[model samples]
Target chain A: MRESRSDRIFYMVNNIFLFIILIIVLYPMIYIVSCSFSNPRSVTSGAVWLWPVEPTLLGYKTIFENKDILTGYTNSAYYTICGTTLAVILTVLAAYPLSRKDYALRNPIMLIFTFTMFFGGGLIPTYLLMSNLGLINTRAVMIIPGALSVYNVIVTRTYFQSTIPIELLEASQIDGCSDFTFFRKVALPLSKAIIAVIALFYAVGYWNSYFSALIYLHDREKYPLQLFLREILIQNTIDAEALSKGQMSIEDMAARQSLFELLKYSLIIVASIPVLCIYPFIQKYFVKGVMIGSLKG
Target chain B: MPDNKTYFYIKKWIDKNWQLTLMVILPLSFIILFHYVPMYGIQIAFKNYRAVDGIWGSKWVGFDHFIKFFKSYQFIRVTRNTIMLSLYSLIAGFPVPIILAIALNCCKNIKFKKTVQLVTYAPHFISVVVLMGMVIQILSPKYGLLNNLIKALGGEEVLFMAEGRYFRSIYVWSGIWQNMGFSAIIYISALSSVDPTLHEAAIVDGASRLKRVFYIDIPCIVPTIVILLILNLGSIMNVGFEKVLLLQNPTNTEYSEVISTLIYKQGLASAMPQYSYSTAIGIFNSLVNFFLIVGVNTIARKLGETSLW
Candidate 1:
């Protein structure tokens, strides 16, 4: 690997370009975190740049003081845990049989599953259906409608076809193991990598999802963190009525407004921690998940 | 005698495979209840749906709801907004990941490469609402970091979020920034799997690093790019509604009012919801997307291109 002068220049240039991209991507996120920790006055005054100025726990303290924010957190966690379980279970049940080489209805059933992806009932009809089923305003709505993802089924089926050997199934069958028993005993255990990947995928989706809850949930208490955050961020504190609910005077109103700004930054950090904290651990599996998903079986 | 013979075959199959069938029953029924039944429920678009009458029992109005949507002023606005935003995002956002993946592939420094990847990928997991919150916080004209910088630099502060003209670019570019690393994973893996022999052979022919990248790396990933493009085309009508809805204000609604948001608004946001009309508009949107996907897929298959199907 003899390097020419031009090759050296090329390497230098490439590194510089990549370095710029790294800064561009990292700065805003770093800035946001810094702002979250900064004194609220410094945050409002724009004195904080790359690092926190007059760092304090006020933003986090304020976030915890609000009962609404805590409820949002607990609700999102419940949905993530319950929804991921149901999603993974349904994906396995749908995918495993279809992955079997001996299954006569595999392709047709796959077609049915995949067809739903391209064409659907769309938003309005789906809403109507949810209401009709008594899922609207209920906890069941978030977990139920998203239980069986066709994409997850396909990904899991692909994993099964590639990883779980057909001969192993036959070997088990010779010992009087039925399909259900074999899946329960052999397949699920062997497929932990794919399951972990899929579970993380589903869990991340459940954690971040607010659109379903937005449409179905009318109860303020059932609102996911994202949806509730949407109201705080988008609605802003411009509504004097919402502000006055705290019984603030005109002077205290100004304080509430600035506090809300600090609250937004803190709330964003709080909301992101659950998914982002566990992300690194499962990230390698999900990278494998993406790799598997990209290739068709 | 034939019936008896058929029954015997059916019984044999069922006895051997009943467990598998039983396992799929609940999941299959779930799909039926949610996906298939909503599809069946789409017929409300053709009826004057009444709460008392239900979906099927309602008086059939044929294409009245459809005709009403076709004539409405909002129809043209939403369709245009949807297509423009989709194409804007697709054309602008599609290429960066390939470029990013290629550049990262060239970097010999694994530490820098991994750090860059981790940082860029973090935003993809940020919920749409929080991302929008960040957007507002950073772009707020009065106190935002962006506008404050502009003011310090002796330039007029621009309210990026509040302006209609900046809506599409803001949405699309922010989307690219958020999803670039996450999306590049596939392409990066594709580049990794490229044969080293070809690069060696090219270098032997006096190919520079850039030349090798052009000749070897790009050619290897074209099939992947094509398949991804086809998939993108398949779902081009679905500009993610969540972000648009979050970002939309009264001032920006002109540019931001897409089919999905419109449907959500018309169906749910109004005082007296236009249920049938909204459903009709939704079906029309889905049908167009369905046909576009089929058309693109057929063309790809016919041309011997690696298609999504």
Candidate 2:
């Protein structure tokens, strides 16, 4: 292929643009981490640095000292663990039957799930149902309502259907292995990629989720870290700073506003670190799995 | 005798399969209880709901809430804002990812390609609340980087969030920024499946790289694009409740108060809950999305040989 001069120039230009974009996307996160440990005063004064100046652990100390913050972390961890486990189990089991080529109910069941995706009863009925089921203000509300995501189920099913040959199942059946035994022994072992992808998706959704918790959980202890962070993040900076600092004059507050803003960024860096650390291992599978799941009819 | 034998065999199968049933039972029950049953609660949309009266016991109003919502001064404004924001997003926000995917696809440097993908996808995982916080700070009039750059260029700092006109642009564009990389993954995958032979043929025909991309690569991903478009059109009214709620202020409420926010306020925020009204609006929102999905799917199937269904 004869590559033209313009093509080379175009490639160079795009490369430069991509690098700039990379910096833009990465700098806020890097800046947030640096600012979190920097001297509170310097952070307040809008000092920009790639590295922390007069590095201090005060923000971490302060956050750790707060009982509400600790509770929020516990709640979030608990929900993520329990919700992800339940979701993965349900998703796998549901996906298994539907993945069967001879399953008479597969298409209709999938359509039923997809129907819920597009049309839902929405907030009012969902709330009513939760209250009626005695799940309101309970941890069950956080986990049960979102146990099976139709998209994840479809992804898992597609993976199984595509990867697991029907001959394997037929061979197992010839040995007098029952349907359940065949699935547990043969199909389940071969589904690690899809399972891992679905598990990560479920975990991330549970970790980042707040809407369900917001509607169902009334107790402060039940509030997840994201919801608690939401409460802090939504507050007006001057007022929040004043409240935290035990009251200050409105005139004196303007200077401290920048500090509060920095703290907000700092909190983001703090909260996002756990998931960000785990992302590289899973990123390779996510795009492939999502494409297969979404592109299917 | 044959029927009895079949029945006996079916009973035997159930007995033998009870363990698999155990694996599915709890989750299936949860789905039915939480997801499917609440769907019946759409009735409240037509009723004057009272907590004491409950759903069925509540007096039937028969589209009265819809009429009231339609007549309210805020109705047209919110609907317009939602539709326009989503439409802008659909037109502008939708194609940027396709372009980004192509750009990433064409890049020859492997290390740089991975770096770009990593950087872009990171923002998608950042919680909406946190993302909105970053937006507010970065757009702050006092020390915001955006304003600082503007001042450096001798331009005045503008309150991007407070103003009504800038809200939609910022909302839609910011959404594109947060999601562009993550959402483009699907399209990029589709691009990978494009037949290299076609590109080779185009090159032999004296087509330039850009022209080859236009003639070959873009054509291959058309079905993926069309399907994504229909899927996006289905959710045009959603407008993402969390980011809007977090970023909205009193000054911008005129333009930013969307249907979801209105429902949130009425259902949960209000001391005297108007469950019926919120229920009506929720049903109405779903119906709009449903019709959109149906309409777009039908049109795409007719025009492009692709549909979400």
C-alpha lDDT values of all predictions: 0.85, 0.79
My TM-score estimates for the predictions, one after another, are 0.95, 0.92
Using Cα atoms, each model's DockQ against the true complex is: 0.69, 0.54
lDDT, candidate 1, at B115: 81
Number of the top candidate by TM-score?
1
Worst 10 residues of 1 chain A by lDDT: A241-250
lDDT against true structure, model 2: 0.79
**Candidate closest to the true structure, highest lDDT:** 1
Error of 2 at A38 (Å): 2.8
Clashes of 1: 0
**Candidate 1 RMSD computed on C-alpha atoms after optimal superposition onto the true structure:** 2.4
Number of the predicted model whose DockQ against the real structure is largest: 1
